[model samples]
Target: MLELLSFGDQGWGDEMLLAGLMTILVSLSSVCLGLLIGVILASFKLSKSRILKLIAEVYTTVVRGVPELLVIYLLFFGGSSAVMYFAKMFGYDGYIELNAFTIGTFAVGAISGAYSTEVIRGAILAVPKGQFEVGETLGMSKFQMNLRIIFPQVARLALPGIGNVWQITLKDTSLISVTALVEIMRQAKVAAASEHEPFVFYTTAIVLYLLITTGSNKFFNRAEKKFSKGFVIEEST
Candidate 1:
């Protein structure tokens, strides 16, 4: 086992390590994209327009209801075709390949965005309407009010939910192995098959996942504390 994990051509360590880093990169990219999509979806859901609300509801429902693996498969297969079709429309020809990394990241990010929409929308609503009124009274414009008051408080309120979403997003990247992006799970599978050491490689994958989760949990915990630091309630006279 030690020899298997050694850092050289005889060992699978270097491949596995690079794959682990790929997993982190993919997960982080997905989370960032998801957060942006979530904001847009939440805005739609919170809007007064019934059509916008319906659009948001339909999107969240469809994405969340489908199994994640199925989503990845659809994107992996369909995304390429769709891109090529568009290309052909513009007088371009030949196959335009969609890389596994792009497909996996987008697929997982779409699912993550669905859940994050609710978390962020709820966080926005959790902030008291009176705060907006106070901002208006203080002569703050709408953009200023949102930037100075709404966004900060909403972020604090949404931190825990976003942290949970991050955990879910990280684990979901394992499903991307089907797309052949070669994240941790993919590398482990390859190593196990090549070396006939399933137990060692699989266990290593589990340990790597745990380390990521633990580190992320600590980071979020510190973020929560930082955001909550100045929060205090005074006793009414």
Candidate 2:
């Protein structure tokens, strides 16, 4: 048992470790992109234009409603088609495939971003209307008001929700197994098939996931505390 789990060519451990790292890489990339998307969607949601709000609403609703695996499949195939088409306009023609990593990141990121949109939008709304009024009265530009006054508070309030979306993004990467991305789940499947030891490899995969998630929780907890500094929250007795 121990030898089978050993590193180097003798064991399957290295592949498992590499796959775990891939999972982390994809998760980190997707979640960061998701945050950017979330911010944009939140802005659209907050915009006064009916069209912008409708666009935001449609995106969030469609992304949230769709199954994650379906999104991966759609993006995987759709992305390849889109890329191929764009390339043709430049007089280049060849079948192009979007790598699994790109597809996985985008699909998972889109779903995470949808959820994050609501979280961020709510956080923005949670900021007092008076703050906007104050910024206006001070003749602060929109950029200055957001950069100086609104963003920090929204971030502080949104941290917990964002953390939740991060977890969801992490778990959702497993769904990318269909894309053959060589993430933790794909690695487990491969190892289990080759070694005929499904239980062992799957358990190892579970442990790896737990370790990553536990570390992430700690990091987020520390971040929340750090960001909350100088601000006091009242607790009911």
Q: How do all models score by TM-score? A: 0.94, 0.94
Give the per-residue lDDT of model 1 (tens digit) for 1-237: 788987888988888889889999999999988999899999999999999999999999999999999999899989999999999999999989999999998999999999899999999999998999999999999999999999999999899899999999999999999888999999999889988999999998998999999999999989988888888623459
Q: Could you tell me how far off, in angstroms, the CA of residue 209 lies in candidate 2 after the best superposition?
A: 0.7
- Whole-model lDDT, candidate 2? 0.92
lDDT tens digits, residues 1-237, model 2?
A: 877789999898999999999999999999988999999999999899999999999999999988888888888879889888999999889888889999889989999899999999999999999999899999999999999999999999999899999999999999999888999999999988998999999999999999999999999989989998997854549
Q: How accurate is candidate 1 locally (lDDT)?
A: 0.93
Clashes of each: 0, 0
Show where candidate 1 strays beyond 4 Å: 232-237
Cα RMSDs, all models: 3.2, 1.7
Candidate 2 scores a C-alpha RMSD against the true structure in Å of: 1.7
